[model samples]
Target: MNFDEQINKLIYDWEKHAMPVLRGVAGVNSLAAVALLIYRYGFFLTEEETADLFASFDLIFLIFGMVYLTRLLFQLDRWAFIKSTWLEGVLNLFIIIHGAVNYFFGVKLLLSLSLMFSDANPVLQYQHVLSCYLLLMVMTEVTKLSTHLSNLNIKPATTFIFSFLLLIGIGTSLLMLPASTVGPHSMKTLDALFTAVSASCVTGLAVVDTGQFFTFKGQLVILFLAQVGGIGIVSFATFFATFLSKGVGLKHQSIIQDFLSSEDLSSATQLLRRVIFLTLLIELVGTVGLFFSWSEELVFDSFGQKLFYSLFHSISAFCNAGFSLFPDGLNTSILSDDTTEFAISGMRIDIRRMYGLHMVVAALIIFGSMGFTTIEEVLSPSKIYDRVKKPWKDWRIGTKMALVSTALLLLLGTLAVFILEVDQLRHDKTIVEALITAFFQSVTTRTAGFNTMDFGSMKDSTIIIMMFLMFIGAAPGSTGGGIKCTTFYVLLLSAIGDIRGQKNIIIGRRAISPTVVRKAYSILMFATTYNVFAIFLLSITESGNTDIGILQIAFEQVSAFGTAGISMGITSDLSSWGKVIIIISMYIGRVGTLTLALALSSTVKTNSFRYPEEHVMIG
Candidate 1:
């Protein structure tokens, strides 16, 4: 054969044979690579240890990357990889060059400038950059796997549950590692499990002090879990998969539709794209606002630490995960001087001193709880201009209901909390401080766990009010749990219609669908029944302990069920059974109100014939 013919034959053979083998090997090794990198990050390795670790990783990447690139070089002449367009090939070329440059040259340029101002040494900084790149590669491969999974005939609800459960189980094992805790001995398996569940579920109930007990590496693991849990692992993986593939398959779109609670199958792909971009955008904006809002007096010694705090809290708030790095949450004014001394950053500084930070967090929580679909409707650039031009005509019923309900709840909660706490707060804090705390409490109770006041010190009336708010939670499709505001609104309207003796329930001249009303009732029934059963079990297990009260147990159960994370100061004192109960409740809350019901309930055949009419019991 001539040279051109031989070259063409070689390209075809490589594309048919060599590419898969190389990709398969790299894909398998990518897991181990990621695991090793995570271990290195999760531990407090010394400088020598850190250097040796990355050096090994650097070697592995160098070998595999070189082989991959050499194979690519051979195939580029025939455009074996980039089938669609020349630009794709150019992009591929750029990515390969970038990776080679970073890996081979040992350039510490990326993110090194930020590390220069922080406590991170050059060795650690370089390790971080390497770890990040490795993580990106692993995630890219994993996204491919996830997209493939959608081809199977698994229910989306089942997939959602399995994803969280798997993450929780893995996270539990990771947290139980020796390096995860600060002390020599690892945490109790139960405590580690509890923390893992909390983080994985994005429900902020912790059995241990997050800041004091966990090392920086451990904290990072928790943060990783929260981010994974917050946006959902499935959603995260699929977002990248969609980006890489440039579009989603029909099955993948259906799965994404289920995850996002989007009804329009046609827009499922668009919704997935919107969900990811909007989440990142909002979180970025929130982080910047928080960075500026933080008090100078409470500033961290390192710029990186400050940035991490902003990033962590921003994710936590936006995800509606109440996990705070502060031992006392945002209510630092109540912390004793001795307890406050251990804080390395001003994150735990007095709440009154960081009023701006509180507002920023509150805003983030509100946006998070508003649900992605509602936010898309209100914030989408194309709609925003039209909305301003014709506010009433442009907005959908779902968007309007979510916004109106959210506003009403916030207003009612704020007023109730302020009125109930005014006398007590008036004596203990300034009027403005008390008002801010009340406002913050009002927002936080509904699916956010952050607090400006001690939950344990609140009046019984306030506690009851908070329980109601937590039970209602945020809007449907939001990064929160509970019955959802729409459910609560439906129930309220149903009652109002009954009282007025109207046959049809109407809102803004739109008659409600019986299916929607039935669904809303189903959610309420499931949530109420679940909460009651959980509280009952918790009371039984926790009654033996003298330090905690039944009300506190009930409060904790409600908080977990709501994924609100606020505790009446008894999360750590709970027995093993109590912790398990909270863990299950958190899991249920995060999975959602109707989802849990649907997952457990078997579908039944619909009877074509109508049953005999029967009268129900009187209310």
Candidate 2:
């Protein structure tokens, strides 16, 4: 053959055969690599003596998976190979393979790997734990890459995944340090991860007394986690660097869009920026208030304690974490004691101390659970100025609904708590203290579990009040949990609409979207199902403890599930099994039941081409 003909045939074969080989194998190779990761790392190192090995291996594997993912992508895209679907398929396949391996090998691995390394070196432990976190960041990248390859935006998912992984890593790092360092001998990575998750997810369940467990350094770590958690993972990440690092990629913008739930290009980044600004603004104001209130007792004390206290409580309150330096969650000493009538209440802090703490904490919790949209709508300088200029100017639908719903929830909560606890208040000094305790309890019930009054001896009616508030929770896109106040409002509005035979749910002259209604309903069902599942687990595991009742289990489970974290002093008494259940519940609650559902949800999309809608029987 002629030289020209030979060259032409060679080029055509390279394009058709070689390029296609890479594209198809992207799916296959990525899957295999991830599968190998599970069998080799996550499950195989379960013995206690192999703790360091397991830790080191898990750390290496996590980072390795991330690195390997990029390497695989590099091999595929050495050419301009841009098919993201095949990549996603491969990633999904790998995750599935890992899941299968975990179920098959997890128990054996835990028994084997954990036992081998229980007394491992602290430095090595730190190194191993840190590596796991870095690896998590890589995994997050993979998720982002896979989602980008899909048609949907995965920014929110990416921010969430990365932040969650980072939380575990930071918590582990904190717990591994000596008391001279970060202030703990050694905390379980999973437990620390749980605490970190609780702080980052802003759910307040603690296996250890956060006040007594960690040193100031450890407390600081929790504070940092709570800040990141309260702000939404993306907001914190974006604070340092937004999409502008390399001149703003479309994938980054899409991720931000998802995280903020903002479709407007102008406001996409604005939502994150606004959240950061609002968080700092609230924390700053809160710190000042707390410092002023706190400084009185240690009146001549140095600035350092006041500063640290200010920083800690501000984040705790704003995140709605309810983790306090004080042993008994909230001070009931001279503060506000809900159970001054109970002998156990004296072991709680003095009442006078709690009053200032209560008011500051209450204020912070109010802002934290109030929701960002509410902050922007109700407290935005521009909106306020505009309102001053024109009182009748319409506020955003989100703002209007948020205000009405929040007001109704708070008022109901306050009034109900007061009425139920008034008898207990009579033993206390004045109406002021009783009123403050009732009001503070009422406000925190919506999400934050901070109690001016003791939570343990409260009437069953108050617990019921708390349960209802927790179920309703904070507002949409807020720091707190539950189905979310906005969701509750929507469900109520939707019911009203249905009763009236209306086409759509309407509130404040604005019609709510069907998709939103469906999501709200989905969240409610998912939350209820999860709480039930956790309670079921607790019932089997904790039935032996006479002190712990099913009601307490239900309360603890819902508190964790709602990210509410109000315990009936039952958490510490729970079996490790029960603790594990609560940890899982807190993780799910904070990352969000929706996010977890989405994380575990089938990647398999339903057929885009739907069949005709069929009529169904109605109640």
The lDDT per prediction is 0.79, 0.67
Error of 1 at 77 (Å): 12
In candidate 2, what residue range of length 10 has the lowest lDDT sum? Answer: 335-344
- Residue by residue across 529-569, what tens digits does model 2's lDDT show? 88887789899999899889888888888888788878888
Clashes in candidate 2: how many? 33
Q: After superposition, how far is residue 48 of candidate 2 from its true place, in Å?
A: 33
Candidate 1 clash pair list: 298-346
Candidate 2 scores a C-alpha RMSD against the true structure in Å of 12.2
TM-score of 2: 0.71
Please give, for residues 285-357, the per-residue lDDT of candidate 1 as tens digits: 9999988888766756578878888998999998888888877788766333444324453244565558889
TM-score for each candidate, following the candidate numbering: 0.87, 0.71
